[model samples]
Target: MKKLNMISMSLFLLAFLGCRSNDNIEYQANLDNAVRKIHSDLQKELNTDVPSLSVYIVSPKGTYFSTVNGANGDLMTRKTYFRFASNTKNFTSAAILKMMQDGWLNLDDKITAHIPGTSISYVPETSDWNFKYKDQITIRELLQHNAGIYDVTNDDSAYHINGQTYTDYMLENFPDHQFSATDYVKVLSQNNLTYGPPNTVYHYSNTGFSILSEIIARVYSQKSNASKTYGNYMYDHIVGPSSKTPLNIKFPELASDKQLPIPYIKGFIKYADHNEITNQKNASAHIGEGNGIGSMEMLSVYIRSLMKAENVLTASSIQQMRTSKGPATTSNYALGCTYVPGVGYGHNGATEGYLSTMLYDPETDFSVIVVLPFWDLRNMNNFEKCLTTLNVTAMEAKKALEY
Candidate 1:
C-alpha cells in the first residue's frame, strides 16, 4: 500500500502490470496475441485518419511485444514512438526512492534542509506568493502531492513560458538556479500558492514534485558522483525493470533523437468552427518527472516489471504506488496512476492534442495501453469506456493463462 500510494503522490498516469508467472506460458502468449490484435484493430480504425503507429506490448515476465508495423504487411513499426506525458511521474518517484535507499536523503527530511536556494511560500489572500509551509510538508508529502504546492506556470498553468521549450525556459531563467535547491525555492517564491495543514488532504501539485526533483538533483546529481539522476536513473530503477515498457521515462537518454514519430495526428472536425488540430505530442521533457514521453511497448514493459520488480524498492513499494492516496478528484487516482473498476491502477494524459490511458490489474496479470492522437472534448468519456474495455481485455488475457 505504501508504494502504490507513493505512485499517487507523483504524477498521474493510467496503466500498470501484474506479476508474471513463468509457469503460465500459455496465458502469457494469449495476452501477447491479444495485444497485437488490439493494436491491429486500432490501426485499422486509425489508418485513414493518422499517420502511423508503432504498437508494442509487454508481459509480466519480461516477455515483450511490439507491433510498430501492422500485420497487414503495409506499416512497419514506424519508428516506435509515442509521447509518455504524465506517466513520467513513475520515474520521478523512483528516483527519489533510490536517493532514499542510497541513504542520501530521508523521505521525512525537510526539503528546506537540503535544497539550498529554494524557499517554500504560498498565497494567503488572493494575488500573492509569500507564505511557505509552516511545517509537515515532508519528503513523503511531496512524493504524495500532499505538500500543498500549487502550479505557477502560464499564469500558473504555463508549464513552458514563451514558445520556449523546457530547455530554453530553464536555461534562460534557471542559470543562477543551477546545482542549487535554493534556486528551486527562488523559482517557487515566484508563484502564488497557499498551504493547508500538512497531510490533512491530498492535493495534486506539480510544484511539490518539481521540488522533489530539485532535491534529488541536489543529493544524487550534485552531491554524489553521478551528478544527475535524470531519465536514465528511471530506467535503471523502475521503468525498464517494472513495466513491460522500457523507454526511459525520465530523460531522452534512451531516446533515438531521430525523427520522433509525431505524437499528434492532426485532423479536422466536420462540425467545429475551427480547424481542430489533433494528436499533439510532447516528450517526457514536457512534464519532466511529472510527465515524460513514452510508447505503448515501454509503458507495458513498465507495468510487467512492477509485477516482477527487481530494480529497487520492495514489491510493497510498487503496491503502494498502486493504492489510492485517498478519494480522487472525480477520477480514481492511485499514487502515480489513476484507477478503473476491476482494473487496479491506471492513468490518463489530458493535453491539447493527445489522449492516452494505460490500465493494469494485478489480480488478472493484465494490462492495456490506449492512445489516440485526437482529443475530443465532446466524447471525453470515450477513454473511460475504453478503460473498462481494456480491463475486460486484461481479464480475457488472464483467462488465456488458465488455458
Candidate 2:
C-alpha cells in the first residue's frame, strides 16, 4: 500500500511541474507575438524612410527582440551598435550616487563649495563668465533639473553672438567644435540665459549635466589625487564593474571619434527632399549629456543591472535616484531618470539622426529598449509619429510582461 501511494504522489508532482512549464512557454510565445505586432504596426504607421527599427525587451519569462529593416536594407541586429545619446545621463547619475556612497560627496553639497581637501570649487570658478545662483545651486538641484540653468542646446532665445539659437548657430558654424563644460557655462552667462532661481523651476538643461560631469572629474581628482576624465572614471568604476560580460559601450573622448563599431546601425537626418547620412557627426558638443555610443544589448544589460542593484549601485541609492522631487509639473523626472507612469524609470535619447527609448519596471523586473534609426527634426508631424510609436512599444512591452 505504501509503495502504491508513493508512485501516485510522484505522478501527481510530475504533472504539476509539466503544467507550470507549459504555462510559461505559452506566456513567452504570447509576448513574442506582441512584440512582433508592435514592430509591424510601427512600420505600417510611420511610412517614413528609416534605416531600421528595433525593440529589445528583457523579462523574467525571457528576452524578446524584433527588428524591421527599411528600404536602405541595412540590417540591425542585437550586436549592431548605435549612439545612446542622453541615456548617458542615467550612467552619470549612477556614478555620482556611487561617489556619494563612497563618502566622496553628498547630494546636498553646494556646487560652489570647495572640494574636500582642495581649494578648487566643485565647479571651477572662472572669470570668463558669470553664473547666476552658482553659489545657491546644490548637487541635488542639478540632478533633479531644478537648477534653472540656461540650456544652450535647447533654449530658443538669441545666444547673443548670433541671431540663431545656440544649437543652430553651433551646428551650422561649428559642427565639429569640441565644447567643454566651461564653454557652455560661459555661453549661458554671456547670453544672460537663465530660467530663474535655483530650486524654483524644472527645465531640462543639458548644460546642467555638463556641469555635473565637471564636478565628477573635479571631485574624483581632488579626492583620489589622481587626474581622471569623467569617461575614464565611469569606465573603471561604474560601467566596467557592473557588467558580468564585456560591454562595448564607451564615452568618446574626442569629437573626431564619430565612427561606431562594426555592424552598427546607420542614422539618417530626413529633410523634405532627401535624407542625409549623419552617422559620422561629432558628439563632443553634447558631452556628459548626450554622448554615449554602444549596442542595444549592452544598454539593456546595463540598465537591468542598474535597476536590479546588481554590481552597480546599492538598492537604496538606486531608489534615491528614482525618487522624484519638486512640483508636479517637473515631468516626473527623478535625478537623471524619468518615470514613464506604467513603463518604469529610465531615460530617452535623441540626436539629429536617432531616437531611443529605455525603461525598466522594477516591480516586474522588465526592461524595454526601442531604437529608431532616423529622426525628422524639422517635421513635427513625423517626429511626433515616431515618439508615439516608441511610447506604444513601451506600453505594449509592459502589458506583455504582465501577461
Candidate 3:
C-alpha cells in the first residue's frame, strides 16, 4: 500500500502559474485537459496487467468526479466491491475514537483492563513467554503502533521467528480456518516480544489493530449485552453512520462456501503473473487488519462524510483521530489516520491481492480514494509513484473546482 504522505506540489505549482478562475471557461478547459492527461498517462505507466483502478475526487462544495479503468471484470462499475485492506485500520481507529468520545473508554486505558488476562496471555512457554511490559500496553500505544506487542502478521522477516503468520498458517495448515479475534490475541500475546519497549518507535503492526478490534467488540458487547463482531461494530457505528442515503457501505461477509463477493473484481496474488487466488475464505480472518469491503463510490462518499465529521463522530473525536501521536516534527500518523504535512489525512492498505487508499483534507473539504490491484509487494517505489500521480491528478481537479 502507498502509505507515504502525498503533498500536492502540483496544486501549488498550478496556483503559481496563475491558473484561470473556477467559473471561467478557460479553467473548465484546463480541468478537462488535466483529467484527460492524467488518465492517459496512468493507462500507459502503471506496470500491471489486468489492472483494476478506481479514482474518485470530491471537492469542498460537494461536486465530484470519478473514473474506473482497467481490464479486470466488473471493476468498471461503482457497485463492485473491493477489499480496503489495511485501510480497515482507519475504520477501526475511528470506531475506537468514537467509543472514547461517547465515554465508553479512554485512550490511556490498559488493554488488560478491558480484555482481562491479556497481560499474562501467552502461548507455549518454551518458545515465547516474556510479558515483562505487557501490562503497560495501552489503547493509545496500540493506536500509535507503539504498544511493543509482537506483530503476528509481518513480524521479523525470519519466517516463524515467533510463529507462522496468520495468513500463511491458515492457508496451508487449515484452509477452512475461521478467524476469531479473541483467539488470535490469546495466541499472539504468548510470544512476549516487543519491537522495542512501548512508545519507542513506530513499528506498524496489524496484530495491534486486530487486538483493538477484539477490544472494540468486547466493549460494545458489554453495553448491549448482545453479540457484536468487530466488523459489524464498525459498519454499524462508524461507516454506516457516516454514509448518506443510497451510499450505504457495509462490511462483507465471506460467503459460507468461500466465494468472492458477487459483483467483485478479480484480484491477484501476483499482478505481473496474474496469479489469481480465491480469498473469500480468508476474508473473515482479520477484520481490523483490513476487511472492510465496499464499492468504490460508496467508499468515496462514506469517507467524504467522515472527513466532514457528519453524524458519525464528534468534532473533538475527529480532531483526535487526525492528531499525530508520534514525534513532533513528523506528521506520519495520527490516531487512526496517516498524514502529510500540507496534504491530507488517511491511510493506505494492501492485503495479498488488493491495494486501497483514502485521504481527506478538512480544510479544503477535498478527498481522494484509490482502489486498485496491488501487483507486486516488492515494488513499493512504483506503487508510491502511481499513488502520487493520482494525488496530483485529484488535487489539480480540486484546484480547478476551488476557483
Candidate 4:
C-alpha cells in the first residue's frame, strides 16, 4: 500500500473505530459472534465487493481463524503478500541481541566505535546532545528508539502523504534529505547526529535504525572474519532460525502487480477510478528499516516461532527483547515491540496503506496476528478489539477454541 491511501483509510477507520466504541455496551458481546460478523463483512469485501482485499485473524498461537477472507473467499488459503512497515524493527532488534551475546559489542558502547565512517560534528547544535549526546547512546537505546535523536516535525524531511509522493519532494526541496544516518557517518565522519541526551527521551527516528543496520553490517564483517554485510549476516544468524526474510521493498507505486491482495471500502474509496500504488513505481532504495513487503503467512510464521519459544534466542535474551527499555511513546518499548500493560509486548505499524499488528501474551499463552489493507478500514478485522473485549465476547471465543 502507499501513503496516497492514508486520507481515505483514516476517514473510514475513524468512522467505525469509535473514540468510546470499545467501551460501549453492545461492543461487549460474544467473541464468536463478533468474529462471525467480521467474517461476514470480510466475505462481502472479498467475495462480492472488495475482491482486491485480504484479512487474517490468527489465534495467539498461530491457529487459523475461520474468518479470513481473500481472493478465493472461503476457499483461498495462500500466504498473501503484506507490508511490514516499521515492524521490521523487531527483527533488527533481535539481531542486535544476537550480536550482543557474541560479545562483539556492548549495549553501552558508543555507536561510532563499531560503525567506521562516523564523526563528531554530526552532533546537533543549540542543544545539550553532547554529554548524554554523541558517545553516550547505547546499543539498547538504539534498539528501543529512545536514543533522543528524533524529529518527526522536521519540514525538511519527506514521506508519502495523502496522494502525493514525498521522496522526490525531499530530494528536490530538502538538500539535507541525503544527510541521513549511514551516509552522514560516511561523508560527515567528523560529525554526529544527536538531538538530546541518550536514554532521556523517546523520539522515533527511522534514522536511528538505519544507523543500527549499518553498524551490524560493519560488525559482522569484522567479527566473522568475512566482510559479510548486515543483510547477509541477519539471514544466517537472526532470521534463518525463525525462517523469515526481509520483504521485497523495492518500488512502491499506487497500483501493484505483485499479486498482493488489494481491497477497498465500498462506501469509502472509489475503487474503479483509484490509482494503484505500485511498489515497482516508487523505488525506495534504502529507507527500509521500516516498510518491507511480504506475505501475511510470513508475518504469522515469524510470530508463531516466537510463541513456541523456538530457540530463536536464549530465554534471557527473549525476555530482554520483551523488556521495556524506558518511557516510549506508550508504556515501554522493548527492542522492537512495546509492552502493553496487562497485555503482551507488541508493535503496531501504520504505513501509507498497510496496517499490520502482532502481540504475544504469556499470561494467556496466546498471540494475535491481524493484517489489514488500509490502516483505517471500518471493516477492519478487529483483532485488537478482541483483546479488550476478552471479558465479554472474546472470552467465549477463547473457551470455544478447544485449546
Candidate 5:
C-alpha cells in the first residue's frame, strides 16, 4: 500500500511540471506575436519610408521577445549596436552610486569640495565661472537635475558668443569640433548663463551632467592615484568587472571615433526633400549625457540587472537612486531615472538621428528596450509621433507579458 501511494504522488508531480512547461511555451509564443503586431502597426501608421526599429522584451521567467522592422530590418538582429543618446546618464549615475557603495564619495558632497590629495575642486573654480552659487551645488542636485545650471544644448536664447544658441553655433560652424566637459562649462560660464541658484528648481541641464562626468574622472583619479579617462573607468569598473553580466556598451573616447561596429542599423536625419545618412556623426560632445552605444538586448539586460541590484549596486543605494529627489518638468525623475506612472524606472534618449527608450519594473522583473534610427529634422511633429509610437510599443509589450 505504501509503494502504490508513492507512485501516485510521483505521477501527479510529473503532470504538474508538464503543465507548467506548456504554459511557458504558450506565453512565449503570445509575446512574439504581440511584438510582430506592434511592428506591423507602426509600419502602417508611418506610411512612408519607415526607418529601422528594434524592440527587446524580457520577463522574469527568462522568456525574451525581440523584433526588427522597416528598411534593412532583415540585416538587423538583437546584437546590432546603435547610439543610445541621453540613456548614458543611467550609466553615469550608476558609476557615482558604485563610488558611494565603495565609500569613495557621498551624495551630498558639494561640488566645491577638493579631492583628497589634490588641490582641484570637484568642479573647476576659476574666474570664468560667473554663477554666484556654484560652490553650493551638491552631487545629488546634479543627478536630480536641480543644479540650476543652464542647458547649453537645449536652451533657445542667443546667449552664445555668436549671437546664436550654443547648439546652433556648433552645428553650423564646428560640427566636427570635439567638446569636453570643461569646454561646455566654460561656454556656460563665459556667457553667464544660469537658470537659478542650486536646488531651487528642477531644470534639466546637460551641462550639469557634463560637470558630473568631470567629478567622476577626478574622484577616480584621486582614489587610484592614476590618471584615467571616464570612458576607461566605466569599462574597467561599472560595466566591466562590477556588473552581473559584463555589458557590451561603449563610450566614444574621441570625436573622430564615429563609426559604429559592424551589424549596426543606419541612422538618418530626414529632410523635406532628402534623407541624409547621419550614421557617422561625432558623439564626443555629448559624453556622459547622450553618448552611449549598445544593442537593445544588452540595454534590457543591463536595466534588468540594475533594477534587481544584482552584482552592481546595493539594494539601499538602488532604492535611493529610484526614489524621486523632487518634482520634475515632465515625470517624477529620480537621481538618474525617470518614473513613468505604470511603467518602471528608465530614461529616454534623443539625439540627431536616433531615439531610444529603456524601462525596467522591479516588481515584475520585466524590461522593455526600443530603438529607432531615424529623426525627422524638418517635421518636428514627426518626432512627437515617433515618441508616441515607441511608448505604445512598450505598453503593448508589457501587456503581452501578462499572458
Candidate 6:
C-alpha cells in the first residue's frame, strides 16, 4: 500500500521499447491506430463511469493535439480544475531550486539550517531509535525522498482510524478532519521513526515534501520579513512568472470554508460501490505534498515553459534540478522530477479520487498530461481500471506523435 498509491506513473514504461522517430506515412497510420485504441479505451470509462477529462499533448514544434473526452457536465469543461497530487512536488521543488539559483538556499544545506523546528531540533537522549538521525538530514535528501523521514500520511498513529488506514477510513467514515503541515511533521518527530538513514536509501514519503513546503514557507518568510506562505510564493513567483497565459493553480488553505473551484468532476472511491468524495474538507492539509489544483491546459503550459527553459529556471539550474544524486531508487527521481533514463523527465500524482500524469521529453520536446478518472484503490475492484494504464497510454501517444 505504501508504494502503490504513490508509485510513479512511468513504472510500466520502465521496460518500454526503443523510441520510434520515423514520422512517415506508415508511422502516421500506426499512430492513428494507437490513438483510436486510446480513445476507445477512454470511451469505455465515460460510458460507464466518470464524466470528466482534460488531455492535452504537445510535440516539439507546438500544440500537437488537445481533446476533451467523455461527457462534460453543464459546469465541467476540460478546463475544470482538479488536484495535482504529488505532481505538486514538482512545483515545490522547482520553487526551492529557483531559490537556490537566487542564492537564498543551497541543496546541501542542512534542513535544520532552514526549518528550525524540525525533529532535528528535538534530539532526545533516549533508547528510541527513530529519533537519532534527525539532525543529519539535508534539504537535498528530502527532495529526493531520501531524508529518512517518517511518512505521517501513511505511517503516523494519528492517521490511523481504528485499525484501518486513514484513506480507507476516509472512504468509509467520511470524517471531516483538517491538519496543518506542522502537525504532520510533528507527528513524524514525536513518533521517532524513519524509513532508513538519510541519503542511504530511497523511500517515497509525502511527509518529506510537506516539510519542503514548510521550508519554502520559512525561506520566503525570512526573505520577505513578513507572514507570507508557500502558496503565495508559488503564485507570485513559480506559476505566475513562468507562464505566457493566465494559469489558475494555487495551494488551498486548510481553513474549513476553503473549497475547490466548482464545475469540477467528482472523484470516486470504490467503483463497484460507487462511493464519492469530491471536494472533501481536508483535501488541502499538506501544502507541498499533493495539494495543488489547476487545469490541464495551464499545467501543460507551465511544464512546456520549464522544458524550453523560458522563465522557470536557468539552463544551469535546470541541469542541477535534473542531475541525480546518490541513493537512487525506481524512476531515477531527481530532486522532484522523475526520469525515463535517456527518454524524458516527468512525474505522476494520485490522491483518493484523482490521478494525473505529466511527461516531457526534452530531446523531442513531446509532452503528455493524462488526468485519469475516478481512482480504483484495489487492483481487483474494477474491470476497466484507467489509472493502471493511463501513463502507458500517454507514453504511447507521445511515441506515436513523435514518430
TM-score of each: 0.59, 0.90, 0.77, 0.62, 0.89, 0.78
**Between candidates 2 and 3, which one is better according to TM-score?**
2
Query: Of the pair 1 and 3, which is ahead by TM-score?
Result: 3
| Alpha-carbon RMSD to native, per candidate | 12.4, 2.9, 9.8, 14.5, 2.8, 11.8
| Per-residue lDDT of candidate 1, residues 1-403 (tens digit) | 9998878855343322222344445555765676566555544543433322322334444433333333322233323444554556566766666566666666666654543323322111222223367244667667666666654322234444576533446635753223322333445555434445456556676555556655554454444446554554555545665643445443543222323444423322212344354233233223343345556665676655554455555576666666636432334554555566754465655444444556666665666665444432334353343333344444444444452
Candidate 4: deviation at residue 213, Å? 0.8
Go through the candidates in order and give each one's C-alpha lDDT. 0.48, 0.80, 0.64, 0.49, 0.78, 0.66
The best candidate by lDDT is 2
Q: Can you give the lDDT of residue 374 in candidate 1?
A: 40
Which residue pairs clash in candidate 6? 23-403
**Residues 276-369 of candidate 6: C-alpha lDDT, one tens digit per residue:** 5656646555578888888777678777778677866888777766775556565578878887643467677877677777777787777777
Writing each residue's lDDT as its tens digit, candidate 2 over 198-268 gives 86789898999999999998888887779977887777787665544346678886767888879787788
Question: How high a TM-score does candidate 1 get?
Answer: 0.59
TM-score, ranked from best to worst: 2, 5, 6, 3, 4, 1
Badly placed stretches (over 4 Å) of model 4 are 1-62, 66-78, 114-132, 151-195, 241-275, 281-288, 327-330, 341-343, 375-403
Supply candidate 6's per-residue lDDT for 42.
54
Tens-digit lDDT track of model 5 for 142-163:
9999888888877766365467
Best first by lDDT, ranked: 2, 5, 6, 3, 4, 1
- Give Cα distance to truth, residue 118, candidate 3, Å: 16
Give the least accurate 10-residue stretch of model 6, judged by summed lDDT: 117-126
Global CA lDDT computed for model 4: 0.49
- Tens digits of per-residue lDDT for model 3, 1-403: 2333233665676785554344455545555566666656665665554354556666644444445454553444656777777887887887887778767777887765643323322122322223446567788888888776667666545336337675567656866666655545555556544566777667788878877877787777766778777766766666655433334555554434355566776665544434565445466665677777777677677667776778567777778777848542134777878885444788877776676677878777777676655454336665565556545665566665553
Between candidates 5 and 6, the one scoring higher on TM-score is 5
Poorly placed runs, candidate 5 (over 4 Å): 1-29, 40-46, 71-74, 116-118, 129-132, 158-164, 241-244, 327-330
* Candidate 6 steric clashes: 1
